[model samples]
Target chain A: MAANNEFVGGKVMTTLYQHGTLALLVPGLFTGTQTVGELLKHGDTGIGTLEGLDGELIIMDGIVYQVNAMGQVRVVNADETVPFANVHKAHPQPKIAVEDASSDALKQIALKELKTENLFAAIRVDGEFSQMHTRAVLPQTKPYPTLAATAEGQHEFNATNIKGTIIGYFSPVIYAGAVAAGFHLHFLSEDHVMGGHILDFDLAKGNLQIETFDNFNLHLPVHDPDFLETKINAKQAMRDIAKAEN
Target chain B: MAANNEFVGGKVMTTLYQHGTLALLVPGLFTGTQTVGELLKHGDTGIGTLEGLDGELIIMDGIVYQVNAMGQVRVVNADETVPFANVHKAHPQPKIAVEDASSDALKQIALKELKTENLFAAIRVDGEFSQMHTRAVLPQTKPYPTLAATAEGQHEFNATNIKGTIIGYFSPVIYAGAVAAGFHLHFLSEDHVMGGHILDFDLAKGNLQIETFDNFNLHLPVHDPDFLETKINAKQAMRDIAKAEN
Candidate 1:
C-alpha cells in the first residue's frame, strides 16, 4: 500500500536550531497507531510504515506519530537513546523554547549551520528550460545606524538595510516537450544575523513558468559566473537525489 | 448558472492584478479559470463566474468564466465589459535605473520600509502573548549597526527584522444534538507606521491557527484582545456576505 504513492517517500532534511537542536519533516510517518514517543524508541534505521488518509501505507523511518487534520506536527520521535539528542528537554520544552526565541536569533543559528554544511545555494525549476537561483551571505556590517551619545548625552540609532539578488537561468529542460519545465533557485549568501539560525528553504519555484513562459530571460549580476557554478552544482545534486530515490 | 451561486444574483468579489504580475494564491480564491489579465479587467462592476478545480462555479460578477485544466481564464459573459482601469501594466523591457547605486542604498530603503511598516512586530510571533498582541512600534533608535560605509552596505541595509504575533481561537457556530459546531481560528495582527495599517483582526489569527494547528498550543505569544475583536467583526462580515449570497 505504501508503495503506491511513489512521490510521497523522501528523506527528512534536518535543520538545526539556535540551541543546537534538530528539526525535519518526516514525510509519510503518521500512521495513527503509535505516539511520537513510541516511534522514537523504534530507532531511525528500520523502515517504518504510516497509514495515509487514502488508506495507503507510507514507508518511513520505522516510527509512527499522529498529526491532526491540520498540517501542524503533533508528536515527534522522542526516544532517549536517539543520536544527536533532543536538546529541548532541559528548557520549557523543546518546541516552546525554540519557538519563543527571537526570529533574528533563530535565523542566525540556522544560517550558520547551512553555511557550515555548504547547503546555502537554493534552486527551483521555473519552466521546462529555466531555473532561478539565489544565495544567502553574511554582511560584514549592519545596515542600521548606530546609537551614539551626543554632546548633551542623547543616544540615537536607526534601522539596518539588507539586499538579496535573485538570479535566473534558462536550462535545456524547457526543450523536453513538457509545456512547462523550469526551476526557481535561491542562495543564502548573506547571513541573517537576527534569527540565530541559517535560512532553510522549502521550494515551489519549479512550476512557475507554466504561466509566464513567454517572458523567459537570464538576468546576470556582477557575481554571475561564480553564482552560476553554484546553481549548476545544486541542480546536479537535486537531479542525482531524485534519480537515486526513483 | 451565476444566479444559482448568488443570493439574488448580481454581486461577486473580484480580484485585480496587473498582467505579468504573479497571481499569488489568496487561500479562498478559486485558482481555476482566473488569469492575471482577466482578474484585472473584472472591474468594479461586471458579471462573470469562476469555476474551481472542484467544478464549483463561483459567480465572478454575474457571469461564469470557464476554467481549463491548465488554469487559464476564459471569459464566458459576452455582454459584460471588463474595464481596464485597474489593470497593472508591467514594463515592456527591464529598466536598470540604479546601475551605480550601492547595495547598501537598496538595503537602507528596505529597512526604512520595514520600520515604517512595523514589520518587526509582525515577525515576532513567538514572544509572550502580551508582547505579540501589542501593536508594533517603530523604535526611536535603530537596534542594529549600519553597513552603509562598506561596499556591500546597501545590500546589508535592506535585510530587516520584522516580527508577528500568532493568535489562536475557537468559536462556537451552532449547538447540535450531541456536538457543538464551531471553527478553529488563527490570525496575526500587523502594525506598520508607514500606511497606518493597524489591523485588529480575528480572521488573520484564525487562518494562521488553521494552517499551524498541529503546533498551535505549544507556540507562545498570547492573542490580543483588541485584534481579536476586529477579527470577530471580520468573521461576522464574511458570514453575512456568505449568507446573503446563499
Candidate 2:
C-alpha cells in the first residue's frame, strides 16, 4: 500500500556489535541448523561470532553473528539504526508551527466593520466554512438562504456568484495514526492564540492549507486584523532596512 | 513525500472514503458577502449540505445544504462502503490434520535412505505443495557441504554438492517457529523418489532452496508427470465409464 519496506515485504537481519557499530547483513537470509563453529566458517568477516544456540543470525557479506531468534532483519544502512533506540519510539518536537493571522483579531476586525455599517448580523470565525484556511475565495453564489426561503428562489441566486480569498500559513506535524491528519496553522497574530489542535488536516497530501474566512455570504470583511498588521509591518520593515542600507 | 499530490505551500485537506474513494477540496475565490439566501437565488447546482448538528448550510450552483460544525461531509454513495467490511474481515484457513506431516515421517524417510548413503531426502504431497493447487516450480540450488573425512586413503571421497529438480509434490510448513520448514523432492525413476527439507523460502520471488544431508545429486527429469499420469489413468477410467454407459 505505502512504499515502505515494512508493509511491502523485505527485511534484513543484522548483528549488533558490542562497540555500538552495526553491519548490514544479507536480506531475508537465515542461519539455520548450523552451529557457531560452522557459522563462523560461512565466510563472515565481522568481529562477532554466532552464539551456541539454534537461534537466527545475520550473515552479511561474509561475517556472521547471532540475532534474536524471533527478530526479522531490516534492509537499511548500518548507521540507520543508531538513532533508533527501538523502531517504535515517537519523535520529540514532531510538529512545526506555522504563523498565521489571529482568529480573535480577525473577529474583532469583522465586528468593527459590522458595527460601522450598523448591521445587526452576528460574526464568527466559522470553522465549518470550507475557505477558512485556503487561498480559495468564497463562492459568489449563496444556496442556503435560497433553500431556506423557497426551492424556486434558491435556483435564482445560483446564477450570479461571488468569490473571495482566504489566506493563512501552514504548520507541519508527524502522523502516528493509521489515517494521517491534515496540516493546520498557528494563529500567530490572534490575542487568544490556539496551538497544537488539529484543524483542516488532510492525510493523503501531507500538507496544510491556511487562509482567512473573508469570502462567502458571511457579514465579515475581506481584511483580517492580524493579517493586515503583518503585511503593513513587513512592508514598513523592508522600507526602513532599505533606507538604513542607503 | 511519496509524490502523490502536487506540492502546495498551504494547509492540505483530503477526504478518504471507505472503498478507495478520495476527494480533495480547496478554497478558491469569493468577491463580496452575500447571504446564503441571496446566493441560492442564482439557480446554480454546485452546492451541497453536510449532515450534522450546528450544520451551516452551503450553497453551490442552486442547491443548499448544511455543514455541521465539525467540518466533515459524508458524501459517499451507499454502495461504496459495503466492500470494506468484507476486505477487513477476511482470514485464511489454518493448518489441520491432513496438513500435518509428522517429523517422524520425515525421520523415517531420512533414516531409510541414510542406510545406503550418508544422506537421504524426500518430498511429500500436501497443502500448498500439491500439484492441484500450485503448478509453479521454484528454482532451487544444491547445498554445498564441506569435506568431513576421506573414504579411502588413495581415492578421496570429496563432499558432493547436490541440486535437485521438481519431480513430485511436497507441502512445507513452519514447525517450531515463524520460519518455514519442509523438504523438496527430485524424482529419479518411476519407483525411486528423493527430496530434502528446504531451509530458505523467498516469499517475494516464490523461490525455494532446500538443504539435503545426503550425497546424491538429482535434477528434474524431462518426463511430464501430468501427461504420463493422464495417459495411464484416463485409459482405465474411460473404459469403465464406457462399459457403464453401454
| CA deviation > 4 Å runs, candidate 1 | A1-5, A8-33, A37-246, B1-28, B33-246
Task: Give interface RMSD, per candidate.
Answer: 25.9, 35.9
What DockQ does each listed candidate score?
0.01, 0.01
Off by over 4 Å in 2: A1-88, A93-97, A101-246, B1-95, B99-130, B133-246
Per-residue lDDT of B84-130 in model 1, one digit per residue for the tens? 11111111222112222232332233333233210011111112122
How much is B102 displaced in model 1, in angstroms?
Answer: 68
Candidate with the greatest TM-score versus the true structure: 1
Question: What local lDDT score does residue A18 receive in model 2, on the 0 to 100 scale?
Answer: 18
Tens digit of lDDT per residue, candidate 2, span B194-235?
122121211111112222211111101112222112111212
Candidate 2 lDDT tens digits, A1-246: 111111112422111111110100111011112233322321232222121111222333342322222222222223211100101101121221222334444433443333221111211121212122211111112211211121112111110111211212111011101001122121111211111111232111111221211111100111222211211121232233222111
Per-residue C-alpha lDDT of model 1 across residues A10-95, encoded as one tens digit per residue: 52212110100000001111123233343233122111112222111111233222222221122233431111111011111111
TM-score of 1: 0.16
